[model samples]
Target: MGFTTPTPIQEQAIPIILSKSDLIGCAQTGTGKTAAFLLPLLHLLTEANAGTEEENPKIKALVLVPTRELAGQIDQAMEGFSYFTPVSNLAIYGGGDGAGFEREKMALTRGSDVVVATPGKMLQHLRMGYVDFSQLQFLILDEADRMLDMGFVEDIRQIISHCPKERQTLFFSATMPPKIRELAKEILVEPEEINIAISKPSEKITQAAFSVPTGLKVELIKYLLSVKSVPNCIIFCSTKKSTKDLERELNSLDIKATAMHSDLEQVDREKALLQFKSGEYTVLVATDIMARGIDIKGVALVINFEVPRDAEDYVHRIGRTARADSRGVAFTLVAPDEQRDLFKIESLIEMEIQKVAIPPEIGDSPPFDEGNRRRGGGGRGGSRGRGHNGRGGGNRGGGGGRGGRSGSGRGRKPAGNRR
Candidate 1:
């Protein structure tokens, strides 16, 4: 909302939080939820400064997110809002070398009024006595649902166990699950609920799913790329190997895409994100782990090369497209083995996506046909073609700016199939 007006989520949420009550906000991504909490948070902290009239500051606010990308995104947003004010902040996460993160943590310890962190890295620091939150006055669990889904409940519980009980707590998530609701009750103090009504995927996006034999997925993807005036899109895969393989195959077919996940170095992740945001690539191949944290704007399409294991994951993936009140599309390629998972996802979202017709020419070979395999099919060991693997590329502009059209990278790693 730089020069523009606030979104519905922001408008509804900002005022309620400004009253100093704890809140639970359930809204979709791209609804401006970030500003809803950030605005009130900054205002409250700045006002606290006037009352105390102090030159030094203690850690007053803590934001715990699920991923490094989100921590960075929130940190950047805080910096922008606190630009004119004296309230400074820092973002902390893992994936950086130990020494660099340690130095940054020390810098944060010295003066930052707010600290945003991921659970794993934050736990590492807390147990080693590198930082303390006993005096922490405010706590926020952004994307609380994702944290629980990522198996960080123990870490979150340990962190919150150390914070002052009297401190205010606010929990925000695109969607809330039963476990998150229980966790919210444990932490929040007389919380004022601010559940934003818009929790489902956008109606603007044309939702479609296709039940295809596993071998024909690549051919289907190729056919979709060839036919749909596909601008920039995201391809969701179940395995890192599939992600890397699909990316190499797409690039081989002149699709100009990139892969991102846990395996890439932090610096490379940052670079790949920047390039995608800058329109250096048209497609970003990734796994579901990266879904919630990827906040790119104006993504025209979301292609689930593999059906997600859970219904919630399906919502988040399609949420990447149809952002900022703009129109988008989502396609899912369901293999015969995944029919059950597909049914569960559709049931959770409470709507049936129409079946899409796949052209005959998409896959000419069997899905596991090693004979037709791209070079180095299984891992990142594949040669980096014309496109930059991580950092070695010049910025190339597409139709629009990166704000609404950025793509992302994901590392290769497999996760448990939905139970």
Candidate 2:
């Protein structure tokens, strides 16, 4: 992996990191951010181990992520890249059996050259008292923006408090929101900044929007999926209830579909994702938590069940497609009340989303300026308020509990740290 030509992030960030400087990498999803830091970290570890005899490993590098899926993804990539080198690694995250916890205990206590972990699960190990980072030399926050969004600020602070005072830090994020900048200022020391095509959706993704009534979204989705050869598609909803309702609706319509959200057990969620990747299921309905770090190569379509809270999120959702060096389509169903949301996205992207006419079978669309006349259906299946069903416990669920309590709150520690 290191032998391949370096991407823009790798080309720039690797050298600065090799020089032992802190760095802030701003890049979109799927732009080789993993290798940008992993290649250099592995090289450093290999150099440090050149003449030394291999002993029980002591943690030297710590990578903190926002989700278990991301932790696993990074850990798998590290194992692939470090195959030739003697460096060892482990991924510690929540959503597993007790045996999984025991295995993590063994890995953390025995030590690994590199440890990739989610904040909450990592905190559990820390509280137990054997997980030590005394020898830690590198501390990296991958997807720092998402970590912040998932309300890991206090957890991150507590984790940092356990690490060595003097260590190299690297912060990688898709966008430099003000909160991210604030976190960077607090954590980094004279860091070099690198930005590679942030906010803009991938060129390979054909973006389009359908102006349909909130009630007709299901019909529009059915029509689009039938017409387009969407071998593997993800329908992104704003809440877990919506994911469940949509999934149920699609399956009832005989569309091999599954729903993913925080409400499902970790194993089920992982299974659904795996099945979706293997083409066992034609569609997956999920919330924004899957927006980043879950990679399904050559995904043919990404349908936004509704406009996301912001343009950055839309970019992440569309990024799922147009990945693995292939072309894909991103279709958004915009209700009449979502015009301003669409406008925000258009302004951010500097282009219109090529609004498409609603299908005749779906009936009359809502007014173009229907802002609050009947702005219903905020939650899933006619339920309101951030997942009324017993599923508001995902690491990414519940905001202050109304709008975005789980994401983008000021530096407060989020609830549901049990995992």
Candidate 3:
């Protein structure tokens, strides 16, 4: 592996992990948190398993994640990091055929050095009575908050019930909500805590939004893609229906785009993601499922066709771009009803995103008003603005004028040294 200076999370986390103590790590997406945990764990496993000649190698480490995509991503990264080493690993997730399940069963029974899995699939295997974790020494939960959000808390507990209680546990989450803290208390021992830029998007991302009417949001997206010629873009919608609808509209306009949602088969989802990553698809229209954990690099832009319901989700959605010291842009289209959601996001990010004026050809857009969100005002009555010239309007609504109030004042203090 090309070794260089570690990222902030890696620099702080790797040492703690190497100490063989439980740990709680809170960091934003794309901050090298995965490598932070993986590198140290791999080192320990390689050292422990050296010269071992047991007939049945028992599983030593387990990583539980929320999504299949993240499981596969971590599995690939594990392969690369352990390529020259003796460590063996496997990724277990649903949506595969019987042959895939049988392969996972073989690996689990024979004991891969490390096993990464989604909670449901892992629980399914655990119920079979053939999988054993008596020798497990490490238990890791990546995206703990996301798992809780997906209603996997009980499933996680069930999986943990099968593991050895004496094992070291690591909990990594992008956000440190109270629920996460509770879960951490139940799982991890006196673990060293590390929080790195929690709930903050990378500073390299150029953030802006267009206050378009709900009806004309698709037209504005078309204008941005066609006139501005944005390449490698990811447009996020709030629902699967919206994703499919927008994809259809973009395809109708001769734009090469694909849709990714939970309804699609796993193979189709993987193919769509591959096409997006390979530049065969110029744009990927997706729901919030693609917001976190799926790492596709070199994306030029992230567009939020609708505001996410949760403020923290906004951070993750924009985080798809501007990863790893690269510059990128994020845009949000705010409908009148979604103004409250926008205000919440601005409050969370601690800055009022610049409001780009809607193109006159796309018709007038509603004013940036959070108070009038309940009225559901349309674009017909708002003042006409100039075309897409990048001129931004003054701060409006509950954003507290320009830079919003600091989020530092709210939420519990991070349990460890803040970086």
Candidate 4:
């Protein structure tokens, strides 16, 4: 990890965290926010243990991420940075085997220097009465906005209550919405606040949109990919069914593609991301779960199959490309009905996205009719991707509860999760 030059967030945040000051740093994803907090946290932990003879690996830092994928990501990053040092870490998340839970229990109860976890699963462990956080020194909430959207606010409050009151709390988010500020106010006392690259897409991203009929989306994707020399792409779909359907159809057209959504088991989900990262697939069809912190490099393009519900999410979806100062393109397929979403996005970013006409190959399309356009439920409904991990009878509906199993990320109903 020869990260010599730090991004803006890292430059400003690292020192503040090192000083043990509570902080709330706001920045978009892919802006080195992880290292901004982690590097200092690691340094503090390392310095604190410099002369200690006791080596029980007590958890000194707790990072609560919004998604299981992000939890795994932070755990991997910790290992990378602490490779030459004695920094033991564990990533606790839902949707794993019983053995996995046992391992998490062992690490949480026994010891680990750092613990990265998802909010819901972390609450589950805390409820079990085995884990100890009375000595927690640093608490981090990554992707705080997403957690709030997933109905994890109450769970987060509960988890925070269990920790020592006198602790350094750091909350990092892509966008600093009012709700996020509200939470920060409640939790952080005299926190040094910093906002970098707020509510804006990177300048390197070439943004454009296609206003087409919903029916023509698949055809447009087929024609565009066939015509353009796309090295790699991510097609963001609105639904898990559509993700799977598009992947299957793209494969039928002989394009190496895969669908990644809640329908996939934890194993398969990991495998899909691995295959994509390893260059086994040129395209990854997914939902907004991939929109945030699941890093995959050399992504030349991001195609929104349908407009996202939230304006800020559009920024995140496009942020996947145009990362690390490399130029890339973001194309959104906006249905006539989704004009409102597109308008919101343009308004949020304070720039009009270039409107591109669909190719003639994908012929006549539906015209935008305001009255006929149905209001799209674009954002997370209920527990977002907290579907049960069960393959069958034991299906834990997302958010960890007993319910009829539906093979989708935002699967069928199960009132709510324990968290």
Candidate 5:
């Protein structure tokens, strides 16, 4: 009865989600989003499960999240909230070693009440006749934007097609993007919507970007970690190779850091996460692929060792900090060539990121623009072909909707904002 007081997003979304109506919730991350959906799903299941036969209750709930980390995180939350009730659950993700999952199969196959799974791995079991979704009554798609961005549309469709169309549906994402909106129309009927988008970074986090030369990013990271106040931090790289290289450099510098990426074995990745969580490591450098579902607490800083390519990713990267009412900082190291991309990020999020002057000791230099001269270099240009100098021109090619609209060119703002 005493789940922490509702955040604004939760206050608005939970009731609607519990009312047996389809819902689209647009809210920034770290706002008790998991609870907003989990609470209602639990309320529904706890009643259905009470005094019911345990051996064959039939799977009543399914949560499909965008990443493996999120699937595990949500499954844990479900167990925590439903502790005293008859509800049971399982977390299924890809890349885990066979033995770890094999231990959990008994609980999973015993007709547990809820299943949290990643789309690809769940499909493997569904096709093999291991999981039957015929009686599934609730479907929650968490981090819907990232799912669409990562090309999960077909898998999502297949999963939905397998479920009962009359059941309640809940879709949550930090950003709506057009593709998510269209998908919502297809899956949800007469949906209630809630949007709590904080276009700016969280106040607890002091955000600033440094202009650095691409080659010197690792050096800059080394220097940042040298600072006395550097607490638990995550260094974000756009690719796996960079993550490994950076890990090597940090270890060489006597910094306790590890890389968490898809390349690692599932057990190794889980070990890395647990080590970072238990204070055995100070830094966890990772690629954006694992951004959405990691829920580590007390993360004092998030450093974008490599700036993200999309504004949504920038938000996801920064989300690791300022969680659960704790203040944190997110710093981005931007190279000169990436200035334009940073500008695009600003435009997409509708907020200005403060610029941090590089300390002379780092020797990071701004890159020369096409004009063959050094420039102040701020702000991503607009979609309408306007340069930083305010020169107006035609719209950029292949530009149509907010947050990369595709298909028919019609994109709806995330669920609740339309009101």
Candidate 6:
């Protein structure tokens, strides 16, 4: 909370939110988008609850997010910001036991001042008819684009049907795609739009890539870690299997690493995140689940073990590093078949990433020709393709469509980057 200066998004958004106007905020990850909405909303809520004599205060603000991790993170932020105030908040999300569910029910029925929840869990409570949104004043959707990409449109619509129609609605997303725009139109009314460097990686990040064969990705990653001596790093994989496999390989090299994915229980995921943040784990191998809304400070590096199918995801993956204006490094290992994906990423970020040569001991690397690879096929290019199929591409089948968010080869750049 040592925020002396406002980020561009915060400066533009806080005013509009305080004015009680619906707003569409488009800002890249690592910006202060969360604070932009929360600070003003906390002010308004504290004012409204100053002298109320009611036993059960009505829920004033509800924040809907894509994942439970995000819900918990926002809830923590809300608690920190409103510590000296009388405003109370609760985070309701899935993967809890009966006691946790009961606690959430009590808070919802008796009205917490602010509530942050994932769409599915909130919808489950709403269906039970014990939850009430009669006096809900502010409705905020953080990571709106991610919610849509996760196929939460119907759940969102159902949840909105319960809230009052005359509330100030805020839609915040890192990328404002056409579908996000369509959803905004349906919910937001004449909202003031604010965009701040959408889809651009932080200038503090030194971005580079190594064109390596699919078989030697682990070797390349180990080599980089040893040479760079990165104290804190997050390695992003496109699938859970890849995440676990990479974690194992890194551990085999005596590197301390942990894996985070949807398959882990909620407690384990939280523990992994906590350990990573607390320096217990020097490296966190994860799927795209860690790409957005999970903010950790002092991360020295971020590595893309494989290129994300969605180009915008590349921005969020590398965004884990270089946060809070600190300089960091981002390295991506691109195989021959994944060259096209890397090209799309470069096109979206509007700058070609430097291609670093792999060390001679790691053997021959793939040619950095996305065009030629596209003309031929997406095959692994030679006999070195042995381990490629096991890890699978970006859109492999997995729990709850985690891999399916890879948009069907449509090169849609993130919105609001005209400059």
By TM-score, who's the top model here?
A: 6
Query: Candidate 6's residue-wise lDDT over 218-274, tens digit each?
Result: 988888989998788999999999999999989999999999999998889999999
- Give the top-scoring candidate (lDDT): 6
Candidates in order, TM-scores: namely 0.82, 0.86, 0.87, 0.86, 0.85, 0.88
Model 1 residue 305 distance off true place after TM-score fit, in angstroms? 0.4
lDDT of each: 0.70, 0.76, 0.78, 0.76, 0.72, 0.79
**Prediction RMSDs, each to the true structure:** 14.4, 11.0, 12.4, 11.7, 10.0, 11.9
In the range 178-206, model 2's lDDT, one tens digit per residue, is: 78777777777667777674457777889
lDDT of 3 by residue, 103-124 (tens): 7787677666678999999999
Quote the lDDT for 300 in model 6.
96
Model 1 misplaced regions, further than 4 Å? 3-5, 51-56, 197-199, 363-419
TM-score of candidate 4 on Cα atoms, chains taken together? 0.86
lDDT, residue 386, model 1 = 17
Q: What's the distance in Å from true for residue 31, model 6?
A: 1.0
Q: After superposition, how far is residue 225 of candidate 3 from its true place, in Å?
A: 1.0
Question: Which regions of candidate 4 are displaced past 4 Å?
Answer: 53-55, 365-419
The worst-scoring run of ten residues by lDDT in candidate 1 lies at 410-419
lDDT of 6 at 311: 80
* Pairs clashing within candidate 6: none
Clashes of each: 12, 4, 0, 8, 1, 0
